[model samples]
Target: MFAGKRILLIIGGGIAAYKALDLIRRLTERGAAVTPVLTRAGAEFVTPLSVAALAGEKVFTELFDLTAEAEMGHIELSRSADLVVVAPATADLMAKMATGQADDLASTLLMATDKRVLIAPAMNVRMWQHPACRRNAATLAADGILQVGPNEGGMACGEYGPGRLAEPLEIVDAIAAALGNGPLRGRRIVVTSGPTHEPIDPVRYIANRSSGAQGAAIGAALAALGAEVIFVTGPAEVPPPAGVEVVAVDTAAEMRAAVHEALPADAAIFAAAVADWRMKTARAEKIKKTPDGLPDLALEENPDILAEVAAGPDRPGLVVGFAAETENVVENATAKRARKGCDWILANDVSPATGIMGGRDNAVTLITDEGAEAWERMGKDAVARRLAERVARALGPVGAA
Candidate 1:
């Protein structure tokens, strides 16, 4: 996907800078021509020679190099690439970028660049969690800068949290997504993900074991296919994907509302495991335990979002729903596809024995008007990619099949 692409890689000063070398190598090996730009602080960690060696190109390190500036001004340097990437995007560098400061070469290029930018932030847990950092990150995101991760793990400072740089391959995938020109280009899609929380009281709520991994993956896959995705997600274990609009919600009602608001889409994927029921009348305060033992709680059925959307007046051309079952997965899902009035249904066994409820991998069967197609057990990401490809094939030009 990255063949003939030009990537301007800006390495920031951080313990994670070492990972940028591997990123350069990965980008180059994938047929991308990488232009390495090393920050002064970045040089303290990895030598320019190392970055250049991996990229197989000369490393640009200065804003005012007479010879290089004479050949290509900063504007040209910034505009030369198809995309700009900031690996090991330190808090300081992010702050600079957020504030539009161009005190150095890397920031200058980032400021001047018109191409899409992707950042992989790496910082201490505290710094990453700080209000200022969060604000800047939000600002950057709002400005359309794509971000990969500061995944949770032990940091160099011996602290553990979401301050670790994303794995090199993960960043590579993100880059490919950003540069890809897939069949769904210019299409708009909506995807609902995660387990919605139905409040039973002020503090307590009802939820499922869904980790939201599959939904997040599906959103990412769709984005990789060049679709503009609106991801309506409940509380998810996995972070939302880059390069998509994320709408966070807590209850099934909210998810439904958000999905409707995001509609007029080309397709809709209802992957969220919304609670079947909610408290009829949730108490304002926590329900205290009494000598009378457990209290009788009235339950009410939550809105069937998939059915509603599938049968809505503004329904998309394609509507896909998921049927998670403990038994007779295919049979149940086949029935669900018909019952819900959806075009397709993805059925999966989420029994405890399958370990797929909150697991990394999925074994799913695609149910449609024609028949059921059982897919082999694969990672959530693979399932998402396959589903996305199927969506593309289904919604593409008349002769696409």
Candidate 2:
């Protein structure tokens, strides 16, 4: 897919640096030209000769080299690539990038670069969770940098948590998504996921059994097709997918606000199971059991994000909604499609018997203006792929736009 792409790969220091070798091979196999840059600490783990041999390009390691600097090599090197990638992005490297510190060649190149940067962070769990590191990560994200993974597994330090470098193939896929050379390349999409919480007090709230597996799958599928996806999610059981901008929210009101902020997109997918009601006057303190009687709780309706977005002035070209009905799935979904003013509705039976909620597989009926089409039960990932294909067709070709 990356036939003519040029990637500037920065190998950062970590045991995960070894994976950069495989990442280079994978990118090259997909016809991407890889230019490797090794950091001072990165050299501690991998030799320049190995990186240079695999990439078939000269390894850039210094900022003050006479031969290269005479021609302003750093400036050229920074802007020439289609994408800049940092694999095994150590905490130190991330901290530098976050703070705009250009002390070394890698940091300087990153600061000088005009192209998009993708980082695959690999650090010890404690370091990754430190307050400073967390703040830096948020800063980098706000700066529009893309990220792949720091998957959870046994670490080199004999400790275990979310600090492993993403697998090479996963990085390649993220590169492709970041490159956005696929069918939905120019399209922008918004997706909402998970069940929203409605606070009743400081210690209690209302929620649902949505695991967010399907929504996460859908976001991944859309991104794989090259759409720029803004993922607004509640406290989902599953982590948001890589290669998409994630907006985390907890309550329905917050989810609604986040969705509005992400609007004016090519399409919007309402996959969130938002709460219908919230406490009209939530108690400041936890409600305690009284010997006299049970406490009365007043409820009020929450914002209907899907309907409002569908009817809004800045509505997307295509609006899709999800209906988790316990009975008469198709009939109710068809009604919901019209009621919500959405172009399509994916309806599924989520009764206790179906095991659809919080489950890996799903069976949905696609309700459109034309009619209802029942899809066979399949894995959530499969459902997402099929739905994404339909979305692409409905939006028409990028060239047509």
Candidate 3:
């Protein structure tokens, strides 16, 4: 997908800097031309020779290299690439970037670059959580810089939190999504994912078996198609997709508010498995086991998000909903489409016997006003891609901005 693309890869100082070598290979294997830039501190973790060897290009290391400057000035070099990627972006490096420092070659290129900049931050757990680091990250994000992952895990510093670099394949996918120019370019879409937790008490809640894999896949696919996606997700087992805006919510009420706030979108996809009911009067403390029999908890229906959004004043041009049924899938989903007033309904059999719930593969029937279109069993990502294509086709060509 990245054929003929040019990538300016900057390696920053960190233990995760070693992953940049594999990232270079991944990018090159996909037909991208990689120009490697190794920071002074980054060289301590991974040698410039290794980076140059993997990228099949000379590594730029010095800011004052007479030959390099004579050949291609910093400004020219920065503006020449299609995209700039900073792997293992250290805390110091990120702070420098946030402050617009240009003391070194890597920071200089990042500051001078005209193309989009994507960073994979890597730092100690405490460093990642520090107020200063968080502020810098927020500043960078506000400046429109793209970020992939500092996924949560045990760090090399014997601490565990969100400071690990994203895997090579994940970075490759983010790169592809950033470079893609698909049919959905210039469009904005909203996707809700995961199972909403309805609190029964301070310690317990009601949720479904949804892993949020399908919804995350759909968001990623739409982003790969060049759409700006707003991903409103609950407590999902799967992480949210890169290259999208993520709004994290816990309960069905919170999800509903988040969805409504992400309005004026080109399309909206309600893929969350919201709880049907919540305790009308949840106790402030955890319900204790008493001599009394089971507590009579009064249950009330949660907000019907799909119906409310479909019937809202600022409804998107296209609104899609999901129906995960154990029986009469098609019939029930068809009825759901009419009742919810959505543009399309994706019906799937999620019976435990089918293993579709919390599984990677899916067999879905796309129910539209036209008719029911049953798709064969496929990976969730493939289904997401196909659905994204359908959405693009339905929205037609990009109109005047």
lDDT scores in order = 0.89, 0.89, 0.88
How well is each residue in 102-169 modelled by candidate 1, as lDDT tens digits? 99999999999999999999999999989899889888988999887766567889997668887797
User: Could you give candidate 2's per-residue lDDT for residues 79-191 as a string of tens digits?
Assistant: 99999999989999999999999998999999999999999899998998788988888788779887766665678899976677877876786787788765677899999
Which ten contiguous residues of candidate 3 have the minimum total lDDT?
173-182
Candidate number with greatest TM-score: 1
Output the TM-score of candidate 2.
0.69
Deviation of model 1 at 212, angstroms: 2.3
Model 2 misplaced stretches (Cα beyond 4 Å): 154-160, 201-204, 209-225, 235-250, 253-273, 280-289, 298-401
Off by over 4 Å in 1: 1-64, 70-72, 86-104, 120-139, 148-180, 291-293, 397-401
- TM-score order of candidates, top first: 1, 2, 3
